[model samples]
Target: MAFYDDGSFHQATGVSRETLDKLRAYAALLEKWQRSINLVSSATLPELWRRHFADSAQLAPLIGTETSTLRCVDLGSGAGFPGLVLAIMGIGQWTLIDSDRRKLTFLQEAARITRTSVTLLPARLEQVTGLTADIVTARACASLETLLGYATPLLEPSGKALFLKGRDAAREIDEARKTWNFEVRRIPSQTDPEASIVEIRNVSST
Candidate 1:
């Protein structure tokens, strides 16, 4: 949301001074670690605040305020785009899951520096079980059909799944309907016109 300029994001999100500090620290960590590992695309690093931070922070508002103490699970939380950012914004009980230990290592340091509490799961999504959450988030992780497969098992009956997708999102939803029965709402992205957030609820096998 016009995060290209400094302070624009803070204004838009209305985050506290403490939360802003944590986000700044997170940006620093991402820049530092990127040289050694591919946390995010090299091109996007120059626009980290707008492309990554803002993109991730946008999910906070979509969540219902009634859903307090939200249990959030971020599937394939690479560089913790929305997951780690959500943790800094104090969303709820956070769990960042990824198969890459290296990425998990980076997330651990980021969480430590930001002074955010998070449960790190360093394993494939299928290996994790008995984990139910209220809000599930996945960004640039997988095809919509595949994401539903992973999320369906971990979501509570009334939970919501917020997935960040590009222009092809509508097609993905159409494809997913072939196997899954659910209610979906599309929210236009504040950053990119071609991108959107797909919110799915009441998911079930067809």
Candidate 2:
């Protein structure tokens, strides 16, 4: 589709032609609704494929398709990139958490338009109380240490935190380790090799 460019996403997410069609339909809806809400950057619309779709689709590698349905939450899911995408990727239950009511409104509308099954939490990330999920995903939200403060409390003892990060990810992980006792995995990011997906887990008091 003209809106998408990343070929790796189709492969990585195991999205067949039909699923891609659904995603395209969702993108179209998002693009239309984003006009009044600012769900995503205007500059990103042209390169939606490589920039948005693929960036979010990269999570499939860490959590494979055909796996049983599991619940996950996206903290500060500003525009519902990864959380909404993850829902379409077959997560049984998904939650999009953000403080801005307007963004969550757009996310809720996007879910309605995309028919994505997800819950919306309109509250500050730090105040929302919930169970640790199978996986917790956040993107472009905060630094590793700050993110740890927000995400760690939402993760189960064995649950993993999949955070999308850029070049400074490794250093951030190093900094976060000073207070968080968790195993970290850095996987190559499809959007930018210099970027990484930091999977954080084992968040227990040392």
Candidate 3:
């Protein structure tokens, strides 16, 4: 989608007024924290609504609406792109995991300011275990192969993983298949045409 303002987000997504208010709060917080820390790419700040908010918001439609609640775990939730955005949208029960404490601190404050609830895991992917969820997500985190390794243990039996990847998505999927076997599909991204959302299910080591 083309870069636009908050009105574009509201018109496209049709999110509630409360959600929009929270998103506005999130945008302000993200911009404030970015000066002191790298919350998002500096270049994307000017178009925050289109670049970040809308990019993350697009994933909501892909998430099945059949269920009233979905337990979601976001691995390597740096500055909470899809994770924090989804939480603000009230997608479901959220667990955001990241290795950086400072980022987590920023997320904590953002959640407080937006009044969004999330379970934050301030730990590395390898350090976490016995965590399962209906939906597992990651964005700009790691290679597809490595992401599968991190997401594998957190998936519920019927869960699926939605990974946002850039132009190298196809190459990463091909490489990931060497050590893993699963049903995977590529969903074209609305924000960046060259990028894609890789959805994986029934994952297992080959």
Candidate closest to the true structure, highest lDDT: 1
RMSD of each: 1.1, 2.5, 1.1
Candidate 2 — which residues are off by over 4 angstroms?
Answer: 1-12, 66-68
State TM-scores per candidate.
0.97, 0.90, 0.97
Candidate 2 lDDT, tens digit per residue, 1-206?
23245355576556777667767777787788778878788998888877788888778768666544677888899878788887876654788889999888877777776677788988887797855688888899988888888877787776888999999997898888787788888898877768999988787554
Off by over 4 Å in 1: 66-68
lDDT per residue (tens digit) for residues 1-206 in model 3? 36488888898888899999999998998999999999889999988997788888888988855534899998998888898898888787899999999999999999999998999998989889878899999999999999989989889889999999999999999999999999998999888889899999999999
- The better-scoring model by TM-score among 1 and 2 is 1
TM-score of 3: 0.97
lDDT per prediction?
Answer: 0.91, 0.79, 0.90
Estimate the lDDT of model 2.
0.79
Ranking of candidates on TM-score, top first = 1, 3, 2
Q: lDDT tens digits, residues 1-206, model 1? A: 58984389899989899999999998998899999999899999878888999999899889854444889999999999788898888887899999999999999999999899999999898788979999999999999999999999999998999999999999999999999999999999988899999999999999
What's the C-alpha lDDT at position 125 in model 2? 79
lDDT of 3 at 184: 96
